[model samples]
Each structure stands twice: as C-alpha cells, then as structure tokens.
Target: MTKPKALLIDVTKCIGCMACYYACKEANKLPETEKVEEDLSATNYTVVKETDGVFYRKLCMHCNEPTCASVCPVKAFEKTPEGPVIYHDKKCIGCRYCIQACPFDVPAYEWKSNKPLVKKCTMCAQRQKEGKITACAEACPTGATYFGDREELLAEARKRIQENPGQYINHIYGEKEVGGTSVLIISSIPFEKFGFRADLIEKPLSDLTWEIMSKIPNYVVVSGVFLYGIYWIINRRMELSEYNKSKNRDSSEDKN
Candidate 1:
C-alpha cells in the first residue's frame, strides 16, 4: 500500500499572507465573497489566522479514524488510503451528522445551494492524484506548510524541535490527538493560543462511537423478544377468558 501523505505546519514560520486561502478558493472553484472571511465556512475550506502575533492555519485534520465518516448515515465522508478525508457530495443526505460529529468543527453546510452538501478541505486529493502538491501547500511562499509522507513529516517535525529546542514548544500537535491526524503542527507557543483543542484525548472518537453502537443490535434483539413475549402472554389470557365464558353459557343452557 502507498504510504499515507500528510502536511506539517510550522506556525512560527507562517506570515498570515492568505495565499493558502486564495489558492484553496481557486482550487475548489469557490467564488470570492464581498468580504474576506477570517473563519472557516462553507465557501472557505481553509484560512489563516493571527492570534496574539502568532499565525496559524485552520482546516480539516483528515484524521486516521474520522468521526465524520463514521457518523455519516449515507457514507458521504471517506478517509482514503491516500490520506485525504474526502466527501462524496452525491451520497450526502444533508443530515449534517458529519458536521456535528467532527471534533474540530471543520465541516460546513452550503446554506446558499439549492442542493447543499457538507464542505471541508479534502487535502487537495484531486491535485494529489495528478502528482501535484496541495494548492495551499504549493502557494505557501514561506514553506510554512509542507506536504509529504506522514511518517516523514513526523520525523522532520521531531528533528526540527530537537535541533532548535528554544524555538518550539517541543510538542507536535496532531501527532497523537484524536488518534493521529494527517495534518501536524509544531508551534512556538501552545496550540491553545491558536484556538486548538488541547483537551482532546489520544483515542479516536470513532472508536468510542463504535463501542456504543456495537451493542445496539443486541439491545434491539433483546427488547424485541421481551415485547413479543408480553404480547403472547396477553393474547393467551384473553383466549382462555373467552373459552371460560362460552363453557359457562353452555352449562346454563344444559341446566335449563
């Protein structure tokens, strides 16, 4: 199997130029809004933000075990072997389950579309298929966002932190959070400064959901059997009562 790809974002190197944002819009063929949006939305797949003088980019994490994929009733979201968590708009049911299930709150709905679908970054899967880098990564002038094999990116992230101990926070976000994502980050300051969820557990959210859902079938079967048993007992009692009333009338007639 081909190794999964990933992106490593070095927040210390980002300049908040918004090149990635525009590149994403062009790649996805999204029209420019009247005003530039600083947040992730249906039209904006990726965005760069500056928080307290630190710049960080936000987009889909493309998790190894995506909760969005698991929660999608129609299987609209897919985590590909190529490392992109892709969306099949044709399969979407507009249930918005993926939007609610995503821990990062990444997915957005196309409220303006007559036929809406969930929207988020696909890690430029189309471009990757054509052997091209992601539009956002390609447009990054400062090399703040670099794309490569996921394993290689992890090694590089660790190496950078080791080489310059004073320059980084020594933690690589996305390396283990939510069971490891394809997008990783190394920041000088805590990721919480960039509005990242630091409290996320290391296990995949999907696993937790699966653990609960696995027992559902058993629960349903047990409840169904119990209900059927109650119905049978009630019906039998009615039948016996009707038979007893018929025998009493027959005895009264025989006595007369």
Candidate 2:
C-alpha cells in the first residue's frame, strides 16, 4: 500500500507571504478577486492569518477518520487512503450535515450558486497520485509548509522540537487531535493563540457518530411496531362502534 502523505507546517518559518493561498486559487481555478482573502470560504480553499506578528495557514485538516465522511448520509465525503478527504458533488444531497458535523469548520457551501455543493481543500489528491507535491507546499518559498510521508514528517517535527527546546512548544498540533490529521503543525506559540481548537478530544469524532448510527435500526423497528399497534386499536374501536349502532337500529325496528 502507498504510504499516506502529509503536510508539516512550521509556524515560525511562515512569513505570511500568501504564496500558498494564491497558488491554491490558481491550481483550483478559483475566481480571482481584487483583494486577498483572509478566511476560508467556498471560493477560497486556504487562507493565511496573522496574530501578534506571527503568520499561520488555515485549511482543511484532512483527518484520518473524517467527521464529514461519517456524517454524510449520501456518502458525499470520502476519506481516501492517500491522505485526502475528497468530496463527490454528484453524490451530495445538499443536506449540509457535513458542514454541521465538521469539528474544524473547514467545509463551506456555495451559497451563491443555484446548484450548490460543499467545498474544501482536497489536499491535492491528484498531485499526490502523480507523485507531485501539493500546490501549497510547492509555492511555499520559506519552507514553512513541507509535504512528505505522514510518519516521516511526524518524526521530523519531533526532531525539530527536540533540537530546539526553547524555540518550539512541546505540543504538536494535529498529532492526536480528533485521532490525528494529515496536516501537522509545530509552533513557538501555543496553538490556541492562533484560534486552533486546543480542547478537541484525541478520539476520532467518527467513532461517536457510528455509535449513534448503529442504534438506528433498532429504533426504527420499535417505532414501526408502536405505530402499527396504534393503528390496529383505532380500527378495532371503529368496528365495534358500527356493530353497536346496527344492533340498536334492529331492536328499535322490532319494538315498532
């Protein structure tokens, strides 16, 4: 099996150049606007944000067990073995379940389009298949975003932290959050300072979703039987009322 690829982002190296952002728009053939976008949206797959003179990139996490894939009833979202979470437009029912279910709030709906679909980063799955790096990683001039095997990148991240104890925080973002993600980050500052969710559980969100989904069949069976019982009782009462009415009419006729 092909090893899963991942992106290792070093926050200290990022200069907020927005090269990756522009490359993503160009690679995806998204519309060009007059101003640079600072937030994720249907049109913008990636964004660069600055806080206290520090730069960081925001995009889809491409989780190993994606909550979007788990919550999508129509199987619109797929977590590929190649370390990308891809969306199928044709399979999407526009239920917006994925948007609500995603813990990272990465998925965006095309509200302006008449035929809208959920949009997010695919982690350049096609490029990986072609043995090419992601567009964002390619465009990164500062080497802030490095792409390679997930395990190897993880080791490299640990090595960086170990070599420079005072330069980086002890924690590695995305290493265990939501059961690990393809995108990893190491930073001098805490992740929560960059608006990253620090309180996320290490457990995969999909596990909880499956737990609820497993009980659905039993709930449906019980509900069906209960509704049928009510219907039967109502029908029996109607039949008895009609029989009583007929008997009274016959008795009145005999008395006359």
Candidate 3:
C-alpha cells in the first residue's frame, strides 16, 4: 500500500513539443513564467528542454522513498499509496528542507507568495481518482508519457529493451534510482546525452541513511548504561577510601 503511483516517459518517442508543458499550466492554473518562449516558473510543475535534437520531459521524479517526506519536520509532504508524492499546502511552514533533501531537486517554492507550498508533479492523483489520465499524458501526441500502474510500465520497458537492445540503452532510467521512481525514462541514446544524471547510488538514499539511523537508539541506550556503570564504580571507590580513612583514624586515636 506504500507503493506510489508513477509515470513512464519514453523520450525516444517524444517530439520537442511543448503541449505537455502547456497542458500542465492550464490544468494547474498557474501564473505564467517571465520567459516569452516557455513558462518555467515555481508555479509551473512541468517544463520541456531540448538539446542536440533530443527532447526530455522534465518534472518531479516522485521517488519511491522520498527524501522530502523524511526530512520535512512539519510533515507537509506525503507519499500516496497510488504512487505520487502529494504536498499539503496548509501544512507547509515555508521551510525549504524538502527542497534541499530531494535528490532530484523536484520541490519548487513559490517565491512570489507570502506562504508557498513546495510544488511538483502529483502524478495526476485527482484525475486517477476520477478515472481520467494526467494532463501531460492526455496532451502528448506521440504517447511519450504513458500513464498506468508501475509494474505494467516496467514490463513494457523490459519488453522494449529485449526486443531491440541496439535501439535502446537497455536500462529503465527510474527502475531503481533513489529507491525507485514513479516516473521512468527510456531513451534511444545514452541517458547522459539526454541530460540524464549519470551518477546515482545503487541503493536508494534512504536505505543507506535509515540503516545507520535504525541502530542509533540501541547504541544510545547501551552507551548510556555503560557510562552510568563507570560513574557508580568511581563513587563506590571514593566511599570505600573514605571509610578506610575513618577506620585508620579510630585506630590512631586508640593507640594514642
């Protein structure tokens, strides 16, 4: 039930179309960005970037073990069972910890607002609840961004990889990055050429961090007891020395 909803993006199929970007803007009813070409603003949850004849649909990765949820002190962000990381604006305290913690740098603050919620892709949770698809998925003419269960998407990715190894890099970009992502990417060229990040740890960032944190409480209790024992022993030694001195003084008085 902890499993989050995810989107599967096949960049090889994507044309440098801004339909998805415009769809997201219209759906969210966000303010326009300063750029006349494209609105890439805090309110804009989606953006398109083109380079060297390659195009990518960039937005929140929606990590499986979201760092935003873990680091948020006020519990503003939540990971839904369906697979999207949803931010509760009312709960947000304007703290930027989530922005810093996310490896994908997905959370965008509304600098224009006095109280801004961290914003990112919600995987169209509302649309899914209503039996509809996301704005981007609906708007995509080439079907680059597919909307469905994560398992089905991954299977489709594997099928593509097996069917044509030469055509694809043979890796699902989000299959298991940062503990697995709801949004998966498959590209024709090396992912790096598509502006994909090359360096990612084998384990999700949380697994490595949680493993150490899980041991901390036990260590603290054990260390506290050990220190307490040392203090008791030192006090006992002082008491014993003082008792011996009293007895020696009594003997000297008797001899006198």
lDDT of 2 by residue, 115-151 (tens): 9999999898888888889999999999999999999
Q: Which stretches of candidate 1 lie over 4 Å from their true place?
A: 229-256
RMSD of each: 2.6, 3.8, 2.2
Q: Could you arrange the candidates by TM-score from highest to lowest?
A: 3, 1, 2
The lDDT ranking, best first, is 1, 2, 3
Better of 2 and 3 by TM-score: 3
Q: What is the TM-score of each candidate against the true structure?
A: 0.88, 0.85, 0.91
lDDT of each: 0.93, 0.93, 0.81
Tens-place lDDT per residue, model 1, 149-192, is 99999999999999999999989999999999999999999998
Candidate 3 structure quality by residue, lDDT tens digits, 87-175: 88888888899888777767888887776767777877788778778889999999898888899899998998889888788889988
Which is the leading candidate under TM-score?
3
- Which candidate, 1 or 3, has the higher lDDT? 1
- Model 2 / residue 246 / CA error / Å: 22
lDDT of 2: 0.93
